[model samples]
Structure formats: structure tokens, C-alpha cells
Target: SAAKKTRTMTTQSSLKDAFSSYADDLNHLNDKREKVVKASRDITANSKKVIFQVHRISKSNKEEVLEKAHKDLAAVVDQYVARLVKELRGSDFWKLRRAYSPGIQEYVEAATLCRFCKSGTLLNLEEMNASLSSLSDPSHKPLQINILDYILGLADLTGELMRLAIGRISDGELEYAQKICTFVREIHRELTLLVPRMDEPYDMKTKMETMLQSVMKIENACFGVHVRKSEYNPLLGSGDPSYPLMGVAGGIDL
Candidate 1:
């Protein structure tokens, strides 16, 4: 109905439409969030399984286990992102676009397998001590610790321990040994006391397990028994699945 002399169109109705659009957009955003959350949950389960199984094996086989875990994680993460990207092709997802396409590109990019890790550079005890000796001049001031730095400092700590334990010499490194000892003690204490934070979804972790589980499912379907490979594949580089035919851990030519 044309009002008495129509004051130009009020912007109120346009604002309402805009708000409605915003609500729809927010709902769409939530749906994507839920998907990533679920995927992250799956990936976390995989990470835990890998950690547990790898730790059970001989210390000699740590590299193979770690490499396999890395590969499995990379593949699974790629698969997850692929699925999310596929969904964005749907008509319903068309109007609900901002920037992140299903919200996993960053994760996929970061989950790369380190080639340097392929070498038997076992972030062990010797390197740790050497580093500590070099960095130990900070006697005037104690070193700061955080998760990343702590783990990064592992090789040096391990070296200190080796020199103390194996060389039968704990004199020169008494302070460094004490530092390493304190670090390990604190890490273990936290593990024992704190509960696994099941808060944020553990991304890429579940996706890896899902990939492994798919193999088990296939084996169960065909052989009627789970014939999935218990040992991790090591020839992890692109190309054939040939295990990197170079070195072996101990006597096992893995």
C-alpha cells in the first residue's frame, strides 16, 4: 500500500534482511565447525594408538615407528581435507562462503613428513649433553621451559644422561644432569597427574586412525580375520611403497 506521500523507503526492512542473512551464514559456519571437530576427534584416536603401539616396541625401532606414524598422519589428513573440499562443491554450500573451504587447509599444509627425520638421528643423549655444555653458560640465569622448547632440548638432555650413565662419569655434568633429571621428572609428573584434555578436537590424529581402520575393515571383509600389517611401512617417500632400502635398526633390515 502506497502510504500518504511515501517517505523514501525506510532502511529498517533492509537491515532485517541483512540480519537474517547473517544468521544463516552463522549457522552454515557452525555446520563446518562441527565437521572439523568430528574429524579432529577421529585423528586424535589415531595419534594415541600410534603412540601406544610404537612405545611398546624395542627402543631400536623408534625411527621406523615414528616415520610410519608421520606418513599415516599425512595421508589421513590429506584424505580428510579432500572430503571437506568435496563438500564445498555442493549447491547448499554455495551461498555460505567466507574464506576457509570447509576449514582444514592450514592443518593439511602443516602436517608434512620431515625428511631429516628419516636419518637415524635419534634425538638421543649425546647431542643433548653437547648442547647443554654449549648453552650451559647461562649459570647466572636459569633456562626457561615450554613444551616445544622442552622437546627441542631433548637431544642434549639425552646426551647428558648417556654420558652420566654410560661413561660412568656424572661429575662435570652434575648440574646438567640435575637439569635433565628435573625436566624428565616434571614431564612424568604432569603425565601422571593431569587428565587427557578431551576438550579441543585432536586434529589429523583421528583421520590417521580412520585410514588404518579402513585397512582392518578391508582385511576383515576379505580374509575373515584382521590381516592388516602390524609393522609400519618405512619406505615412506613418494613413488613405490618400497621400504627405504638403506639402513636397518639393530639387525632388522627395515
Candidate 2:
């Protein structure tokens, strides 16, 4: 047991040494881009914080948290897009642009969960007194999201890894996620650009619907999203219309 303990400690120390060495290099390389990438991964917690903050904000100002996150992620994503575009200087530049497109849709869709929850229309809630409709009482709010949470966890981690891999490119092995970030950022920037124009009528819902429709088609075409309905509705009551999602296990609206 004592020898086992020593071995465990040695392994831990070795891992620490390896991480320390990599971090030092990451901190020093290419204007500390690796550190920035790591920092981005660390900010995943901020998404949860923002989501909860939205719920808190809902109680106070009747403000939509999902909208707030959409605005926030959109703004930061825009800032990063500019930075990312600056990174793509060679033949591979277009790939970076191509990658961010999926991200743009993801963030937009991710915001919807918070939006629907704040609006008391959380459709995935399993124990709601009534179906998704205009509610007269707070008790009607449902919170069934076992499946949704599981899917988002995977996507978020996968995307975070992609971000770090992108950040580390040139300093390390080439990472395709950087290009992915660029593509996503471009889409976010384009979507947000429409906000300030003030000339368009109320088309955001329509636009998002259109975007989701397009996304579904693309995923179906790519074979990235699959359809597998259970015999019974897991969250909502048995319904004619069911939400089809990506991932083999299925995902939330995010």
C-alpha cells in the first residue's frame, strides 16, 4: 500500500510537471495565444453563470436571460472573429472561416433554452402541469432536462477542445478548430450586425426559424444528425410534433 501510494504520488507529480512545462510554453508562444485558448475553455463556466443570471434577471426586470447571453456571446464572439480573421493569412485561411459557421448556430440555439425557461415555456420539463402555453402561474414551469444537459456537456467540451487546438496551431500541431472558430465568429457577426440597422420588421423569430431549418437540412445532408424517436415522450407528454435533435443520445434545444 505504501508503494502504491508512492507510485500514485509520482504519477501525480509527473502530470503536474508535464502540465507546467506545457503551460509555460503556451504562455510564451505566439503572443500567448495558447493561454488565451485555455482561458476560453475556462470561460465555459461563464455560460452556466450567464444562464443562471438570466433566471435571476428574469425575476427582477422580466428580462430574457437567453437574449442577454445571445447578446453577450455574440459580442465577444464578434470581437474574437476579428482576431481570428487576422490569424488566417495563407491557403488554409478559408477553413477558419468555414469552421465558425456551426458555432454561430450553436450559440444561437443554445440561447433558446435559457429564453424558453425564462418565458415559462420550458418544453422539455417532464412534470409540468400543462403543456407549453401562455402560463398564468409560476408553478407551471417544468424542468425536465436530463437529456438536454447531457448533450450540451459533450458539445461544449468538444468545442472547447477545438478552440484550444486552434489556439495552439503553428505553436503545436495544426488544429482545425481555429478555422471553426473563425467560421462561427463570422456568422455571429453577421447575425448581430442586423440588430442595429432598425429598418427590418419583426423577423428575428422567423430568421431563427429559418436558420434552424437550414441547419437541420445541412446536418441531415451531412449525416451528422440522426432521428430516433422513442415509443414514449421522455420529457413532454405524448405529442404529435416532437423535436428532433443532433447527437445519438439526442440533445436539448441548444
Candidate 3:
């Protein structure tokens, strides 16, 4: 009876030890997830700053605006995005995708915006991920921006394009405004088909509404330009400093 009791106590003790070890591991994982979340917030904030910097681009200071935006984007990748890569594992990438997706989407928006302004072409996801590969450790797999984030980011880009279009019209660059209109329209049309098929459709569905609004805003701006072109041509011809056309360029409600 004494030996049996001792064995039972030993088994209980072993179970306690196992439970303690598992608890410690769970705590460690929770800590890591928290760190990744914090890093993701940092990345989201910095990525937004980069987007705002890109919005500062104008026909007059395209080079200066893009240069500053590029620097800001690089800083976001180095400081905030690098932290995400360090804390996240291969499995964690998809599992924590929602936690970090906003930041990644914003990063994609800034990157493609800069590329479009510079090269007049879309920056493919492969190229964007390749740029981030250097930030990760050699032993680990690089964190690649997934297709959903990329598409979601592209959807947001239309809003910025609308703003750019209105600004371009105000700046008397009507053709540039039209080009923006066309680009945003195409993006909206394509996304309409793709959003329904996404794995998680809620976010994309929300963004689709905003994307459609952006498309309409650009279209309205272009329409306003066309409607008033005859009246504005004379003022432009006379080199009016007041630029009365600016008053007619309505703001997008978005």
C-alpha cells in the first residue's frame, strides 16, 4: 500500500510538471503574438504616413514628393515591418494575417502608388515581396505580402486617385485628371468581380463600396471639367491669376 501510494504521488507530480511546462510555452506564444500585434500597429501607422507623403505629390513637385515618400516607406519596412518578420513564423504568417494585414495592405498601397507615379505601371506583388526579403533572417522564410492584402490595398488606391484627380483638375491638368478617372474606373470594374470570390469577403466588400465611391468621384470631377471646359478655356487663355476654375472643382464626399 505504501509503494502504490508513492507511485500515484509520482504520477501526479509528473502530470503537474507537464502542465507547468505547457503553461509556460503557451505564455511564451502569447507574448510573441502580442509583440507581433504591436509591431503590426507600428507598421500600419508608419505606412499611413508614407501614403500621406505620396499624396503630397503634385505636378510641380513630383520628384521632391516621391523622394520623401520613398524614404518614409523605406523606414517603415526597416523599423516596423522587420519586427513583424522576426516575430512571425511560416505558420504564423497566415494565422496572424488579419492582425498584420492592414499594415501590409497600406504598405502595398504606398509602394504601388509610388511605382505608378514613377513608371506609369503596376508594381507586381512578387517584386514588392522580393524587396522585403532582405529584411528577414537568412534561416527563416521571408514574409511575403499575400494576394488578398495586395488586392485590398489596390482597392484603397482608387480613393487616393480620386483625390489626385480633383487636385489635377484644380491645377489645370485636365488630361491627367481624365487619365486618373480611367485608371480608377478600370480598378473598380475588376474588383467588382474579384471581391465576391475572396476567402474572407467582409473586408473586401466594405472596400468595394468605397472603391465605387472613388470611381464616381473621379468621374464627377471629369464630368465637371468637361462641362466647364468652354468657360475655363477663355480664363486660361487670358492667364487669370484668380483661377476661377478652382472654385468649380468640387470636393469628393469620401
Candidate 4:
């Protein structure tokens, strides 16, 4: 009887120790997640500012707007995203992905928009993570933006591109508007094939639908510009229309 009682005491002590370790781990995880969330919010806010800055681009101030946007985007990488990298170092990326995913997606959107506006090309996921590679420790696995987040961010880009196309149309830049239309259409077509295979198919599906709308908006704007040009052609015989974007404001909600 005494041996059995001794065994019971030992088992109770071991159980207590195990649960204490569990509690400590839970607390640490919670604290790290909170810190990561704060950093993510900062990243989202600043990335949005960069997007807005890019939206200020015009034919006359294209260089100036892109220059300022590049600086702001770099600051986001240096400040907020660097903090996120620090928090995630030596940790399982999949474990905390949900905590930081939205911010990363927005950063991708902002960064890609800047690159596209400057060069008329899509910024790939490899180039994006390569930029962040400098912030990571050489000894540790770097925090790379997964293809899922990259694609999701790109899905959101169509909305902004729609807005930009509408604005360009309003500025009498029909050629630029058509360019955006073609780009958005290509993005939509590519995304349609990938949506079903993505990890978060439902979310991607929603974004795909929204992306379709954005594509149509761009196409519609381009069509309207073409129609306006045709109607004005006979009256002005190969000359530019005085108001190419007339009534564009009323038709476009973006």
C-alpha cells in the first residue's frame, strides 16, 4: 500500500510540471501573436499610404509620384515588415500565417503596383521575397511571402487598376486606359485557372469574382472612350476630341 501511494504522488507531480510548461508556452504564443498583430496593422496602414501615393500618378507627374511611392514602400519594408520578420524568426511560418497574412497581402499589392506603374510589368513573388531577404538572418530560414498570399494580393490589385484606368480615361489618356484593360484581363484569365487549386479557395473565388468586375469596368471604360472618339471623329476629321472623357464621371463609380 505504501509503494502504491508513493507512485501516485510521483505521477501527480509530473502532471503538474507538464501543465506548467503548457501554460508557459500558451502565454508566450499569445504574446508573440499580439505583437505580430500590432506590427501587421502598422504594415497595412503604411502599405495603404503607398497605394494612395501611387494613385496620384499623372502623365506630368508620373516620375515624381513613383519616386515618392518607392520611398514610402521601402519604409514599410524597413519598419513594419522588419518587425514582423523579427517576430517570426525561428518560428514556424505556417503556424502564425493567419496572424500576419492580411498585412503581407497588402504589402504585396502596394509593392507590385509601384513596380508595374514604373515598368509596365508584373512583379513576381520571387522578386518580392528577394527584397525582404535582406531583413532576414542568414542563419535562419527567411520569412518569404508564400505564393498564396502573393496571388491574393495580386487579386486585390485589379480593383486599384480599375480605379487608375478610370482616372486615366478622365485625363484624356485613352491609350493608357486600354493598356490597363489588357493587363487586368490577363490577370483575371490567369487567376481563373488557379483559384480552385489555392489553399483558400473560397477567398480566392470571391476575389476572382471581384477581379472579374474590375476587368469589366476597365473594358467598359475603354469601350466608352472608343465610342466617344468615333462620335467626335467626323466633326473634327482626324483631330483630337476637345473632351474625350465627357460624362465619364457620371458613369464610373470608382
lDDT, each prediction: 0.36, 0.38, 0.81, 0.89
Looking at candidate 4, what is the lDDT of residue 170?
78
Q: Write the per-residue lDDT of candidate 3 for residues 60-145, one digit (tens) a residue.
A: 78899989988888898898888889888644688778778888887888888878777767789999999999988888889999
TM-score of each: 0.34, 0.25, 0.85, 0.93
Q: After superposition, how far is residue 212 of candidate 2 from its true place, in Å?
A: 25
Score candidate 2 by lDDT.
0.38
Q: Which stretches of candidate 3 lie over 4 Å from their true place?
A: 1-7, 89-91, 230-254
lDDT of 2 by residue, 1-254 (tens): 99999999999999999999998866655444433343333333344444444434322244554567557644534444223333322223222322333332243233443443344232232332122122222433321223323233323323332333333232222222233344334433445455444233244434534444433333343332113334334445667444333222234534
Ten-residue stretch with the least lDDT total in model 1: 164-173
Ranking by TM-score: 4, 3, 1, 2
Per-residue CA lDDT of model 4 for 216-243, tens digit only, reads 9888887877776688777667665444
Prediction 4 TM-score vs. true = 0.93
TM-score-best of 2 and 4: 4
Global local distance difference test of model 3: 0.81
Candidate 1 lDDT, tens digit per residue, 1-254? 56733433556667788899999989886786566456544544553443343333233554776677666655544454334334433324323322332232223212211211233223333332332233223332211112222232231222222232221111222232234344434433443332233222243234324433433333233232112211233223344433222223323444
lDDT for predicted candidate 4 compared with the true structure? 0.89
